[model samples]
Target: MTVNSISFPHPVLGNGDDISDGSISPEISFQISDESIRVDVTSLQTGHPDFDRMIEAGEAVWHLRVQCPRTYMREDFFESGSNKTFHLEGVDFEGLVTIEVSLVTTTTLATYRPQGLHEDYGEEKFRLGRGEVVGIGPRYQFLIDKIYDPLKAPVSSIIRIEEGEDSEGPFTVALDTDLIMIHLSKSDYKEYAGITDRVPTVIHSALVLPVLADAIRQIEDYAESTLWAARLKYLLDIRDIDTEKPLQAAQEILFSPIARTFREVNMRLDKGDD
Candidate 1:
């Protein structure tokens, strides 16, 4: 039996003996916040009795795949579910995110992807019968350059930070608000994921400090010198960090000069110390 027709992903063929072309259009919902993203899949009707009963009765389980900028995370399956939600916690993902929600017979969760369902990769692939792909809300990117996509750029660089091997949840980065956010480069992501020689490599912040300074210099040249009459204030969202170190560093770098200059001008005005 030649199986044909598929609404999304693509049209394909299955086994000759199987002959059963089952499709489940489960309801997928999503909500995003500063901390984590929550996804719930309901309306679990697949026209298969055992499958339907298993889902409604909480026998069917689920796992989640959350795709991020430069990387992706594969999470464990929900313990049991009828209309349960799987939370992608401690996840620092912005922009368009694709999540594959799967319902499986066994407790083990399989890593699902669109290409895996292809005929060539079938046997070793994570079958699609148990899963559906849903996208997050529209992703807005603040490209640094006035025009041109970063993915199309000849070269690209990025700084990434995340929790260690034993941790869970999104990795938080404190920014000064003035810095522009570049969207994730899909080209770099693909290479990085492939573990190829030309793939993106994780580098230390210090390594990119020069590139950052140079970029800033270009902006300063374009905008001319930025002068402010009032004191410069830094608003930081204090998370899990040693505040004293950063505070001290800032004081030494900027405040020290201001303090010294103010004292010199004040002494000159007084003429003599009382």
Candidate 2:
């Protein structure tokens, strides 16, 4: 989850109505090269009397939390100074990486009166235990899209058609990789490929729909298995697609490909076209 979405019990620097000076901003930059990611916190301004005093007296410290939840990776770093570098293994990350920064108490606070806290916050009298987060900064998100060969891109990019073994089944979906591989019987593959150019929508309804339906199911159990799975999961989350009903989710993802297929067929027939 992003830092802004979290609800803190006490006043925070970046959130509403806290810190008189309004300057608890941290700037973070990520430099990714191959399998290494270098995180640099260039500037952090703790511009307030209480925060300054806490830092000077060693009562608080800066906490940086980095997470790549899709890959189930998380790392935390604490430092007294604002500027710091974190060397991370980038290969373990996929989809999205989140960075959360906070000002945490190093020692227990019997009574803390942060300036400029709104009166709604019960006159700002509060007590916090050691390591409690007194202030938070903005959340940062970076998308780590996995590189793929152009031919191996997902159905969102391309679908690979190959002749199937045994020449029995109508079609089978090999949806494990980013590329959706549709294996059809030898004869069926030839005919299917020849006709696909004429009825693209119908081909999508007949083939792509099932692949996507299966993809939805795969994402539930194996979203982190491959780059495509993680990418699909990210799409589903961002589009608010409900994965409980795989067929419906697939239809939504493809914009009702089945319905559009029929519409295209009927239009062609009406115009006396193939």
Candidate 3:
């Protein structure tokens, strides 16, 4: 008898948000025959301690059964790289997918063992083990040159595309003297091949200023003066000084009272003034 579809009695385990304490369990089903059993399993939360324990304990199991075919299997049912059989009604039994089962467990603990104390002070940690059911699908790569190459014609002085080691991929784009790099996924590179238009204004805007004023203020507060200066220089070099509104906002930050004070102090020192 050939197996049909396997029904999972419960939802697959998932990685709960509470990393400190969380657990999940999913029911797995398998289709089987008298001679062979095909089993597959997956867990949404693969890295948690609880999951690890479940695997180690062998608590997860798949129930199997064999199904009798209503008619003789057809040749078309066995497609390339597939195990499904064709039914008389033209339904593909290649739907009989195979899955491998495995168990995983993990543990975490935080403790302090003082030299004078006989007992250690500690916290117990637990996490779930996550499982993945592997499968195959399409493969592709991003060709950065196809898209960024044309961008140079419009902003060659500020943006340039460079071809790296072939292994690095089709091509890569560099903005100004800074090392800001963007990689295109293979699918996106292929989609870009059909388009002949230049980059959109919205994209250009986003590329120039991905963050807001508040974010800049936070950066200035948290980063060192040298680092902030270098970041600002990079932005100014790639951005159109006159047309980009974000540049004006950044300029205000550089000339702000706090920044002005720092510059004044440096200027005085350069003038040899005590």
Candidate 4:
């Protein structure tokens, strides 16, 4: 999420307050190259005397969090200075990466009041619990470029789900030059693809899993040359899935949907949802 989306409990430095006004000034910069992302915090100054006092007393500390949700990667750094690098050797970061800096309370603070606590807050002091953010910097974003356009990539991309004719079977596979199309019978498509679109796992478990499993088996023989298979193989190779075991690889890549189904059901049951 962006910096503006975050709701801070109190006035934080660097939002709009100037450095000369005794606010925080974190001079942060970053670079990405050759399978590594480096972030530098050249200067971290808590200009306000109250914030400075907390830092000196070890009640607060700096936290730098980096996230690459596309690659399922998140790392947190507690260093108060420069030179932080995150290695991304085997991770495939196909989209956005974000970095956030926050000053968090290390210990619970009673009746804490910063130097310039605004009267508009309706209180001069606040009881801040441990781990609460005392100050926050801008949330930075960087886009990672991809060789293939995401909208045309296979499976959910070029290989897509379609509604089949009334006379067609419940699930049908059509392998084309640029697509691996899975057609669900008209009624089933309406139910799963249309009405239940928000929860895609239902469709993936029932339809995509079998189709992907079959595609994996045919990769070396019938489907290898197809664009769908090429993309599928790339996905498996990047995640280090063993294609020799087709069913296992498909399940692994799809995040073991059968198990996920049971877990979801149990969660709903626990919540007493109908």
**CA lDDT, every prediction?**
0.36, 0.75, 0.30, 0.65
Give the C-alpha miss distance for residue 13 in model 1, angstroms.
12
Ranked candidates (TM-score, high to low): 2, 4, 1, 3
RMSD in Å for all candidates = 20.2, 6.8, 22.1, 17.9
lDDT of 3 by residue, 22-85 (tens): 3323233344343433333234233445434443455332221222222223221111111222
- Give the worst 10-residue stretch by lDDT in candidate 3: 135-144
- Sorted on lDDT, best first, the list reads 2, 4, 1, 3
True-structure Cα RMSD, model 2: 6.8
How well does candidate 4 score on lDDT at residue 267? 79
Candidate 2 has a TM-score of 0.59
lDDT of 2 at 28: 78
Candidate 4 or 1, higher TM-score: 4
Which residues of candidate 1, in runs, are more than 4 Å off?
1-22, 53-60, 107-274
- Positional deviation of 206 in candidate 2, in angstroms? 11
Best by lDDT: 2
TM per prediction: 0.31, 0.59, 0.19, 0.47
* Tens digit per residue, CA lDDT, model 4, 155-240: 47535777788744567787654567877787777776554554556666777788888888886453323555556655765578
Off by over 4 Å in 4: 14-20, 81-92, 146-274
Worst 10 residues of 2 by lDDT: 149-158
Can you write out model 2's per-residue Cα lDDT over 153-227, one digit (the tens) per residue? 335553577889856667877766655677898888888878888887787788888787887787746543455
- Error of model 3, residue 44, in angstroms: 69
